[model samples]
Target: MKSAAKATPAEDSAETSTQLIRDSIRVAIVERRLSPGTKLSENDVGNLFNVSRTLARAALQALSYEGLVSVAKNRGAFVAYPSPDEARQIFAARRLVEPGILREAAARITPDDISQLKQLLLEEGRLMSERGQTARRAEIKASGDFHLRLAEISGNAIMQRFMEELVARSSLVIALYGQSTVSSCGHSEHGDIIAAIEGDDLDRACRLMLHHIAHIEADLDLRERKSLGLKEAFEL
Candidate 1:
């Protein structure tokens, strides 16, 4: 058997730059810094990130595959504006899977995992108190990270990937529809779920998981809103 060829330095650089752009855009979307329907012009993105248009296009295309960006013919790329029905579907999927994921995570969770979860909860609560767009964005990301971390602890690779999509989509939905200034996932609720899991109460943990997801769904207004300007939305 022949060994696989390695990527040259130039190829590695391009891939790194592309991934960096993609991740920056993804974080902006997921953290609600960028609103739905905001245009992501390749030229602007290239200039913003100091990369070529080709690299920017690649980044946008990558986000499109993740259901976080929409690329239309002749319309350019925009942050995904999920419809009300799509929002319902996103929560529906999360409600269907998160309880199971929570249970599996509980089954496999170690002491270190529990400690890490507690630490995340602490950080999340601290962020909630701080005032600033940057802190708010970090808080939102940390809230989503709680669920994503649970999926990671489940020891199911496929479920982990699915949860990633669901969480990202959920962020978009909440960004457009959420009535509260804070994320729909409550700070106390995360702590409660962790407590249940620590106490070996899988049933309560699952129920709490469902309720947590439901709280997010219940907070949605689900009406259309005008898009924020890219410069203001991204604070560029």
Candidate 2:
């Protein structure tokens, strides 16, 4: 699983500090490091990345526009929580939208595209196999980016950007309502979707994409129920 990365000293010198902060936050959001409704203290973030509060504020504002974070007049920036209704809506939109993208990828997919996806999946597998907890987290993050890559290859930059946000937000929703497993991602679905695309079979690609996303949606543990642990209620 792709873990969120702390800002390295080298990256701190990059141009456009605000955008770099924004990208870091985006990775955190995508990798499930920042959960829904978690408060983002501007000063804390600034301190962590060694940036000024002004740069951190700009990054938070950008995330607000992306629908990943919510900003209040007094409460400041916090991770956005999607209500159950919005969760249903976003998943609906993605299922309706992405399968078609897979179809397009099937139609226009170059061998080089398959090669690139293979490389990404191989990295994912390596991280999973080695259990390099930290590297796996980063790989987990990059895995979710596969959809955006597919969209670009499908010849739609606009939808590609939109899919990137949807995929990221999907990670948030799953984190919010899904069971607290160590893995941030399902991890294997990316290769499954790409396999359909590589077969050069559009219908299969559509079906695979739908099935993969449906699997993600079904991962939520919506029931707010739990039993008491031993010694808590019964064993005393």
Candidate 3:
């Protein structure tokens, strides 16, 4: 068989830059630094990242496919501002799938997996006590990682992918409508879920997981907003 042709140097550079811009923006959104409905004009994004507008548009388009950004016909891109119904639907999706995910994870979970999960919980707790945007962001990501990790342990590739998207989109929902700064399930509840898993109580684990998702959904205020600025959201 012939070896595949490699990307040209310029193509490689553009691809790497596009990925970096996309990831940076995704992280900002997940960390709540970027608010829902914040405009992400190609020109502004290009200027902020020091890339061409084409690259900026590419990045935004990537995010749109992830359900994190919304691109308009003539307007441009904005962080997705999930409505109350949309937020409800997101949580419903979680509620429907997480129990099954948890069950699968429980069936396959190893002691090492439990240790890693506990470590994530510990790191999340530490970040909760720390004061700063960085700490808060880490805490939020770690919180989501708890669920993502569980999905990983489940050994289901499709469910893992779904969980990733669900978690990312959930970040957007919580950023827009959450009453508290805390996102995802509560910190203690994570420990409880882990304990249930470790104890081989899959039934209890599933129950805790459902409660955890419900708790997150209950914290949403789900109201409309007037305006948002992308420059401020990016802190650029």
Question: Largest lDDT belongs to which candidate?
Answer: 1
Residue-wise C-alpha lDDT for candidate 3, range 1-236, written one tens digit per residue: 14421211124344488899999998889888999989999999999999999999999999999899999989999999888888889999999999999998888888888998999999999998998888888999999989999888888877887888899999988887889756546999999999998888899989998999999988988765534466656775
**C-alpha lDDT of all candidate models, in order:** 0.88, 0.76, 0.87
Q: Give me the overall lDDT of model 1.
A: 0.88
lDDT of 1 by residue, 1-236 (tens): 14421211124344488899999999889988889999999999999999899999999999999899999999899999999889999999999999989988888888988999999999999999999888888899999999999988888878987898899999999888888876647999999999999999889888988998888888899764446667667885
Give the range where candidate 1 is weakest over 10 consecutive residues by summed lDDT: 1-10
Clashing pairs in 3: none
RMSD of each: 7.4, 6.6, 7.5
| TM-score (C-alpha, index-matched) for candidate 1 | 0.86
Q: Which ten residues in a row have the lowest lDDT in candidate 3?
A: 1-10
| C-alpha positional error of residue 159 in candidate 2 after TM-score superposition, expressed in Å | 0.9
In order of TM-score, best first, we have 1, 3, 2
Error of 2 at 141 (Å): 1.3
In the range 1-236, model 2's lDDT, one tens digit per residue, is 14422212235455697888888888887777777888998998899889999989999999988889999998788999887777888899999999877776677778887898888778777776665657756765766767777877777666777887898888778877876454545567777767766666668768877887888788776553244665566866
Candidate 3 local Cα displacement, residue 227, angstroms:
9.3
